[model samples]
Target: MGHRLADTSSPARLAAPDEGIGRDELALATRNHGLPLEALRYDVTPPGLHYVLTHYDIPYVPDDTAWRLSVTGRVQRPLHLDLADLKGFPQVTTRVTLECAGNGRALLTPRPVSQPWLVEAVGTAEWTGVPLRLLLAAAGVDADAVDVVFTGADHGVERGVEQDYQRSLPIDVATGTEPEVLVAHAMNGAPLPPQHGRPLRLIVPGWYGMAHVKWLREVAVTDAPFTGFQQSVAYRLRQESGEEGEPVTRIVPRALLVPPGFPDFMSRARVVRPGTVPLEGRAWSGRAPVTRVDVSTDAGRTWREAELEPDDGRPWAWRRWHFGWTAAEGEYELSARATDAEGHTQPLQQPWNRGGFANNLVQRVPVLCLAKEG
Candidate 1:
């Protein structure tokens, strides 16, 4: 696609405490779309329904035959492979749940001013491609390789750093089997759509979306850590300004409730009948499988364990949970929190970071319960 760079510097900043969303943030919002809370009901998110956050314009590939993936730098043999050659490697299809790092930024008190997502930037699908480990093996990575830098064709400027969209994986992660990264060419059994990275992309199973570079063009094995803006200056968790912040990596534990009943069109608040009602949602974690989910109908003052659906065997995919609630005619607040096997649980109050990365806060839904009369 055509590239569009920010004409001026665009850096991250927090909104005024009393302020509303800025036009710039709205502009970013228009470019990226979050998954609808209701789409959680689907086991495999339709490609069109999946959430997407493109840092730049989607790269245009009019013909798949012409695209090439080059593997170079610190390798015994450099590879220049087109689509046909990549497909020759043994293929794998993995079902993964991907979530944006800034999923709940808008809810922060002095919201960090980027991608104002409100807990809906997530989705899951089966990705099919060659395992990346195989590609590196074929390239014969040098023994001292420290990191593998991936460059996507989409170019843009961020925080005044003009460069190609890029990210790097440490040698262990790049070659590991735990997350089993993929050089994905297909999503949900079909060729990737343009916005999802068209001809090819990367799928880092447990990591947040950014690590999965889209519209990939180059893979370079390096002996040094990548200091690209996206890697070092962005996607970090800093409480204040100018700290070498913790690197934002995997997805944190989170649970979200599907609004219980019919919604009031303008306001999206739930309206339910006064009776026992079924409540269901999805929970997931990149650190481990969600072991338990707790539902709170009275604003988290009290919590009841929800029955988690038996594991479907896709560890990296979100699992479903259901709880039944007896309702009365009144206004109520609803919430859900998850605890993964690693003992990590979501916080009721969001943990803040300068870049708005990994903010896994519990969700609150305002619901009005009314009686159905003859």
Candidate 2:
């Protein structure tokens, strides 16, 4: 099917200068240029429109200098790896979707306190780098270690608190084969542009972006879980199931249960005669494949199946599904919810969390009916 987004000349701003870019400047780029990012997973987000969330004002790590990836802390053999050292190890490439932990938080009710993201807060890329386990194996992880801490070079002020960016992954996910983790030196086959964490960045293919720290300068193999601000204060999800709510500090790995992509017009709205339109949208599940996508027209009163695109078991990619319905002269609401193969359906509304992480509310895009003019 043909895309509805404008041509390449439309100013999408993926590789533009940061002069006019503001806290929310990317919105225009997403709406104007069909984000050119490819899903690499089932969702198929184009490469150019991937969302970037950073703590610093953007750090540029030069290519000429000899860069190093240090593995310190509790390892038996603390190691420092230069680019050549990393290259000397076996090279692995995996296509995985990377999404901000707070990707869909903007859609939450009462609005969480975090960066407001319109739907474009994620992207997938073919990451080529050395396996994280290989480095850990060389470092000889201590038998009693509990976690591995990753720190990046991006620095910024959060609520007047100046801090270096850091986060941790459990030793299991950090060392597993399915994680397909990388100390990526390149993104989409180029020395990663500085804005996108140049030189070296951690790429945990199936996990959220928080685990894939960019511009990674140091990786500490630790005996205990990390307590960095990004982990303790930010990216913490309020645990609420049915009625009880508690806060857990340990970072839990999240999967792309719902695929990422634009919404489809399930049915056309008509303010005049004979003007018909098509409905489309995207769905994904991080832990499992999306089994079905349900569309609603009369505000949850009636349900219908939207056509789902065939999917392979690619981690973090979204599925594109669509349905077509007739238009009538009236106001209507358009919404979608995805059910994973495991039967975890998106809630009509996700709960409010202090840090605004892991929000997977049913997606709704509003459209108005207007009369055609001659």
- In TM-score terms, candidate 1 sits at 0.97
* Ten residues in sequence with the least summed lDDT for candidate 2: 7-16
Best by TM-score: 1
lDDT by residue (tens digit), candidate 1, 210-257: 999999989999998988898898988898788998888899999998
Model 2 misplaced stretches (Cα beyond 4 Å): 1-44, 239-276, 369-374
Which is the leading candidate under lDDT? Answer: 1
Q: Write the per-residue lDDT of candidate 2 for residues 1-374, one digit (tens) a residue.
A: 68433322132112133333345535533332222222323343444556677655567655625677899888899898888888899998776666666666555554543466645466666778999999999999889878899988888666445677888887887888866678998877777767668888988765667778888889898887777766765555553323223323222222221322233435422222324545666665566667888887666668798888876655445666767766555556666777876777766656457556666665554445544444
TM-score to true structure, per model: 0.97, 0.76
Task: Provide the RMSD of all predictions against the true structure, rounded to 1 decimal.
Answer: 2.6, 10.5
Q: Whole-model lDDT for model 1 versus the true structure?
A: 0.92
RMSD of candidate 2 to the true fold?
10.5
